[model samples]
Target chain A: MDIFNGIASGFEVVFQPNNLLYCLIGVVIGMLIGVLPGLGTVATISVLLPITFGLPPETAIIMIAGIFYGAQYGGTITSVLLRLPGEASAVVTTFDGYQMARRGRAGAALGIAAIGSFIGGTLAIVGLSLLAPVVAAFALDFGPPEYAVLALAGILLVSSFGSGSAWKCIVSATIGLLMASVGRDLFTGVDRFTLDSPQLADGIDFAALVMGLFGLGEVLYDLERRIKGNSAPTPKVKNAWITGTDWVQSRMAIARGTLIGFILGVLPGGGATLSSMVSYAAEKRAAKDPSRFGKGAIEGVAGPESANNAAATSSFIPLLTLGIPANATMAIIYGALLLQGIAPGPQLISEHPDVFWGVIDSMWIGNILLLIMSIPLVRLFIKILQVRASIMAPITVMIILIGAYSVRNSIFDLWIVIAFGLLGFLMKKFGFEPGPLVLAFVLGNLLETSFRQSLQLLDGSLFGFFARPISGTLLVLMIAVPFLVMAVRLFLRKRVAQTDLQKEYENA
Target chain B: MGVPTRRSQDTATQSEEVGVVEADVDDEAVTPAGAWSHLVAGGVPLAFGVVMMLGSINLGLGSPTSPQPGLWPFALSVLLIALSIGLLVGRGRFGPCESFGSGTLTVIAGVGSIAAFTILLPLIGFEIPAIVLAAFWLKILGQESWRVVAMVPILCTAAFHLLFVEGLGVAIPHLFSF
Candidate 1:
């Protein structure tokens, strides 16, 4: 009955006028950002982080959560109409979605994608609502040793599963941990890396670092591309209604997608992009005519769209329950929660029950808003894209600078943002995925404090960590995950290659 | 004393074990920059690690039981150095990063403008610098026509003023009041 009570309270919180308004605003911004190619969810969230500070934690999270899932469906519009994937997860949508558009079934494709997204998102919310409390309850028994090990394992998983080399990702993570170590040491009261600045005592502002990396950094990197200007013409959207056949075909695809997406989204690094890709493949295999897979197959669009949306919703489970960010974007949300003075771990359900239930329940509301708005606003979103890059460049830069200053009303944060901006740009240029770095940085202090406390219990024996049942099991699993993943991936690649060869032989 | 010594040794080995699990992917992001960019990338972290370590040691590495403030950071600094070394040894084989090219000047100008804005903000309040920065981005960076360049800065600055200063009553200093 605690679950029911929590749900009831969540509805009470979300239905408030202030929260409802913010939710509407968030979904709109999310749709626009999703439609735009140059900017992404991470950059958008970073820009808005400062603005969220003034709002209540529950309201802030509700808005942010709305933006996240709204962006998932926004990408589908561009994919079907313009053959451009607005988000990484939407890449698979462009394949059959664009083909459907070319075949003059654009309306059918769009309508089905919207419907599929709704089902997938709604189902994922149900899963999150059911699963989050259970996970939180299970994690309540965890001590410092378990926390320290869990934090390390989380970062390790993100790095190993990231797009870049494991070495580079880990190295990036190390830098984040190192940065987290700056300022005075709490235990001994000794200054570590303050560089003699009094303001450094409290450590670096999370807002400044993130705004620099994701916001200004993306702006700087995308500067050249903006100069060239966008060349794609907006396609007209019409008759956004699907046929019975289309719905029949898409229903099963959406169901399978929801399942695939929910499972992957719970993992440390398997987020929307990976889940969407997996769902697309699964749909293709299940199809009666595999040849129709890429050439305007409605299931192709339905499955991946559903999967991406579902994954987007379910990825919140880790952060809300375990206080471990599942992906890069979640890392920023985690930072936002911390800045709100709301600690996100097992105690969150009891300590900040309003915020917890409110965020989850808000997703249900946000998804409905996305479905209602996305189809009608297709032209408006396309028009938003037509606005010259010149207009956006100054505005984005201005917001970033002003936002940085808002952190503590300090001029120093402006400089800090610029420095991290340059560093972030360089890292991106060098193919370093900033996700692991951000995740590691967010978790670094938590890991450190827990580790130091755990050491007292271990009796000064470093080996005692692995000798304990919980920490030891976690560490062993941490070691095993990368190897197991690599082996499975290798096996799959070989099997696919053989399958391709056999298909070629049969065709010949 | 012996316990502290043994703990440090154990931590080092454990770090190395983590390091050895360097499972690589076929990364598509990096273009073939010369070893120079790779060297710079590797060397920055290495230098950063060394500097942090020196400071950490100065902070004092207490026993695991006692756990000084620097102990965790100090351990991390060592790990940082090892990882950077591994990166340097990579010789651009894993993912050779992109070198700075034609876009360097644009970035430099962007950074330079941001720096100028930061300096001018507290000195002259936010209006003049805001106008100047907006104009530079829209005109110089954006390469828009004179009409757009003339109109956007003042209007945009006014909107920000309305939102932040008037609506929210943020503590930022501004030259004008309504």
Candidate 2:
């Protein structure tokens, strides 16, 4: 379909009352989670997953996507008000956002951030609409070999770029693959790891695992530490509108941030956090007086805010077109899609046009909703932040436990949730990332299927993967990434060591 | 997407620490007890890998031409073992292992409550277990006020009952099945 028709139809999907309502709910929940520090989008989405079980696939995705991007907006409220970032992406915003608040220009800073985020997110949607179909069409001809290589590269890139050590990420992913191997083997119809248990026969439940690992696990971890309530006085918003000078100063920064965020967001492992930091640095560098950055500069708030929202939106490109999640949040969304029986990939646009377009279109509406509601809702969201974590944590755990049981109405699933929850807590304590494990679990079957199929098609020759143009390129890139990272690290280390040597000589 | 070089691991740890503070819980800070902790952490995956390898051997490792189910798992097991060894070898670089301290007791209580809920829910229904779990957490772990500890559980349980059972019609085992 053409871009114009796709967008028009997308609007039609978004206009449905059900989709619109869910979109609103999603954003509201997203904002709430974003404003609250302990509960992240990942856990929130996991806990809420069962609620979407009865909805149509398109509505389910639209709502979940809303939560993902709407969070980018919600995070700014805390950063500007309390100098405490409610979300990881909002960390940089606290620099100038809090400064502006202290200077009694809090309203102006927030207003500019909201405006910039709207523009950035909307622009990214347009870019997604224009680019997604082309990429999907290009990948339409990917054979088993290409898919195998792509999946391998995808897993590797996510692990290497993820929050933990590459080896740990790999181990987590390997464990996920092993978990996916449980139940009856697809190819052989033989039980690989079920251990004669009836529940194990069907394989481990995804919803149960997620709720346990992310939801309950989070609760346990939070139990280990005390959460201090916010003592910062709420900044009064006397004037929420930015002056004409503020607009002129921030317009270019917003545009640059949008562009930077969009480009970076499409890369595997690149998301809101990276984009925000880079945009802030970029704005600082481009400014005539860089010294104004940490001192209530509107550009500082505008740039990173725009960049994060834009990055959040554009990160969908990989998940939608390539079937590879760009970051941890996208990985959860990918699982949601799979639960809805939709496998996201190059064929998704062709196979599920309504779902594909509806999600993208709803993003435009979600942004509009955020822009309209953020100002009015800021006070309400701030009130949510004041709620004590002690009260919230157990309630969240109960919800997760019950939610886990709700899926398939099995008590065995509850046990699974508890088990994985404990495992997740220990993993966190020991510094292992659950994101890669989840991502790997979601992609495990696909990876294995592609690998075996590629081998079969290539007459059992491993070199067959390298014979194809696309697959070969992907394999080469995968092989090169680790070496490249190692080289960069080595160079950086040498530079630091040399600098220290120079300091020592000077001191002597 | 914004910055090319910012590591996500750093962001995750920062957010987690932030969450801890926001929750108003005082943590007993202690450094990881060096090699022993590292050994424990790394040993887990190594143990699992060893068990998996042993299991796969019984399943028969078929050739590449027409692979068996065990072949793929065996490959991953080998990878897991290798990574675990690497982790042990470079344990110092991974950072200080955090001692659970006083929080360990809280974790134990929390987990115990969940286990109690699971065992009791099927037999006695969800209401009592739910209330008890909430109250335990509030009073004991959270150290909430007696008034709050008394009131919140009943209110939360009522709300959840309405939402999950009455409104959504989820098939939770309640005291009154109707």
Candidate 3:
């Protein structure tokens, strides 16, 4: 009854005219950007973050949440229609989705994906609505030490399991921590890395850093390679309907995918791409005739589509409940929340119930809008894919530069954008992921402050962290995971080598 | 004749699409030529960490019981140095280095124009610098036609002026100071 009441009040917030309008705008923009190849959700969100600076926090988050899930649905369109995947999560869809499209069932494939996404997304929201409050309540008693450990574990998990090598990720995160220390020390009033510049006194602007790293940085990297135009003929969708058998086959797959997606989505480094991959593989393994997969099986489309959407919806759990982002997009949203002066944590639900619940309720409305609009808007989105990156790149760059300047009307921030843009480009060139860096930057101050507070509270005993049950377990896991991974790798290598030697002896 | 040639060009671009896809996937990692590149890449961060650690010592690293301003940063710098060393000795490769391809010049031009715009904005205001940046990107980097190169920057600049300045009342520096 409390959950229902909470959700009902959430719906009341979403029904506000401006909130509804921004939801529509967010989805439309999400779909348009998702239709384009090189422009990703991160870049799009970073570019649009400036616009949200002028709006209410709830409205801003509602629109952003819409963009997040809407892009998940939009990504399916390109994967099914073209062999090209619009987003990383859509990659698995290309195997079966394209085949179904080639067999003249593009409409059915799209229809199934939309339905599955709606089901899965709605289910995940139910899970989030029920689970988020409990988790936040549990975390309410977490002291500075627990927060410090959790933040450390979070950074380590993201960096280790994220896109790049663990060392590279750790180094990137360390740099972020150092960068966050650039301003005046809150307690001591000593400027750490300001280089005697007055502008650096307030520390680096979060907006400027994000705009440069994600927006302009992406544009610069994209310029290195030419954008290839899609030549695949758009599949005709004569029937925008699924057959009875299609529903029968996919019903279980959808259920399985939603569960798989939600669990994976809750983990720090686990995301839509990993969940979708797992779901598709699980569907194939579960099928009576696995050979039919990649040859126009409806279950393939249903499973991954459901899984990715579910993952996207549930990824908000850690962010909304724990004050930690699970991935890059969540990190950007985390920054957006911080920009709005809202510290997202356990207290957020009790403190800013409107933003927390409004965002959750908006996801349901957003999915409904996507389900209704995506099929009709497919043709329009395909046209968006035809726009050359040469034209789009400069425009995006211009927007990023202008947006950075608009943050504080300071030229210094513009220089910061350019500087970080160059740094981000180089980082990408060196195979370093910017995701960990951004995540660490957002959580850097929190991590440092909590670490200091814990030390102060514990009277400078480094071993005091282990005295607490929760922080100790987390700290142990943080230390153990990397060594565990290394040990496993070493064991596997030795086994393989021994086997190779035995094979040589047998041949002799 | 024009139609046939244009169609052929389109097909050529289409044929290159698979390569672009492969390149995008492979763009995540590139095998370095040798340990030298890794050394250089890893060394920069190592040197930065060492310098910062020295600076932190000067800034004062207090006892854990009574921590100073430099304590956290000093610890982080040491960790950074350790990680950099790990990277240097580790067998992993690095880099997705920018090829000296056709777009290299375009990228340089793009960066140059942005830097120029940053310097010029405070001096002359936004309109002229914005127009110049747009013109450079469109004409030089994008290689749009002369007509487009001339028209788009003016229209885009004027539209930006109206939107950011007149509409939103954002305090962007302007020539007229309105």
**Structure candidate 3, residue pairs in collision:** none
Give a tens-digit lDDT track for model 3, residues A390-424: 55666677678777888888999999999998888
TM-score for all models, in order of appearance = 0.91, 0.92, 0.90
Root-mean-square deviation of candidate 1: 11.2
Q: DockQ for every model, please.
A: 0.24, 0.35, 0.35
How is the predicted docking of candidate 2 categorized under the CAPRI scheme? acceptable
Q: What's the CA error at residue A431 for candidate 2, in Å? A: 0.9
Model 1: lDDT to the true structure? 0.80
Name the lDDT value of residue A357 in candidate 1.
Answer: 96
Number of backbone collisions per candidate: 0, 16, 0
lDDT of 3 at A188: 88
Off by more than 4 A, model 1: A487-508, B1-31
lDDT-based ranking, best first? Answer: 2, 1, 3
**Where's the lowest-lDDT run of ten residues in candidate 2 chain A?**
A499-508
